[model samples]
Target: MVDFQERDTKRGLREDQEAAHEGPAAEGDGAADEGAPPPGDGEAEIDEVRQQLEERPESDGGQKAHPDESAADPGDDGDHDDHGHEDHGHDHHHHEHDLDELGAAVVTVSSSRTLADDPSGDHVVEALVDAGHDVVTRELIPDDYDDVQHTVDSLVRRSDVDVVVTTGGTGVTPDDRTPEAVRPLFEKELPGFGELFRRYSYGEIGTRVVGTRATAGIIDGVPVFCFPGSTDAVQLGVEEIVVEEAPHLAGLAQRDADEE
Candidate 1:
């Protein structure tokens, strides 16, 4: 009876050990079955995300998926390029109307000078001629206001004269009357001429440039520029300013004649 009891006790301990090992394995299996997703759940989620991306607008995230469809059309690119060229052309079209050669008149206004002694007028004529312009007529007149006005007025009315350049009587002295005499005849006053002249002259003459009354205007479709009497000043005005701008000014001033 004692031997039988010992065998039964040994079997009982062996069964208890097996139960402990199987208990943990069975709980692990239950966790996997209850907590894990279905077999096709991951694929279904991937499909749903792909469908949402496909349905998105091109302006949104869809552009990254299809690069060719998002590229600029070739015809649209050509139109943009053509529009840029047209804008560039329009900006420079006025250059075509500028004159290649023009007629000019030179006048010197001084109380103590003649054509033989007029260095400023000489410079004006030489510069204009050098720049391929014709000096239609040159005159030396006294500093009288009426003389200056009448001389410039008569010159501007001539069909052969496209521009008039005068030297002298453009100072602040008591006899200075070029601006006074010539301003009333102007149909349009070019204030920029005097402003730029003084600005450029300021480097050479300092504040003394303020005494200069150099001026310009449009009179009877002709551009008239009045410069100071000094040879240096006239040289600067002619070479630096007049020669550079006169052709364009002359062309635009005669636009009415061209239209007619």
Candidate 2:
């Protein structure tokens, strides 16, 4: 009986020890499993998506912006880009100054059209006034080269005129001598104005745009913009180019005059 009791006690102790060891091992395994990440977690997938978006090229069916788009965006910080367009290289904001209130003169170089009949001239005056610019003088001069020259010279010399816009005498005809009359008086010619005008005109009139001699320049301290006699041409020049850029141009012209 004594041997049997001793054996029973030994067996009980072994069993209790085994149970205690197994309990802790089982609990540890459960805790490790609970703490481990699930198979195929979203972090890897998210990383893959970000990598794809970052690596995708614009030519690979991705929408790309214009070269000057960053500079054009008002929200963009004009930082020095690897593409070579420096922040200080271009002042896309030049138009925001000096053009708020301008004193302009309108010269209609049409022998046949009076102020009552001059639609283009009227358009110029109205557009300028609508933009809050003052039209100091409006003259309907003959298409003669000397008269056009004299009128423009007189207008530029006036204290009230910051800009002079002439409509008519810019076509490829016998009387289309606006360029000839105006070129001599210009201290600096804005060739880009004619180039951009012709480019925009080409979209409307196609190949025939080559015949028009639309031009812009600085005469004394005033910016002179010459346009065609047709109402459509006048509107195109005013709306697309002059109205948008003249203030900036006038400011630059005045600055140049001040520096000189």
lDDT of each: 0.86, 0.83
Best by TM-score: 1
Q: What TM-score would you give candidate 1 relative to the actual structure?
A: 0.70
Cα-based lDDT at residue 43, candidate 1: 57
Give the TM-score of each candidate. Answer: 0.70, 0.64
lDDT of 2 by residue, 31-64 (tens): 4333334555445655676677778767525567
lDDT of prediction 1: 0.86
Which number leads on lDDT? Answer: 1
Per the 3 Å backbone cut-off, how many clashing residue pairs does candidate 2 have?
Answer: 0
By how many angstroms RMSD does model 2 differ from the true structure? 17.9
What ranges in model 2 sit over 4 Å off?
1-97, 256-260
lDDT of 2 at 244: 86
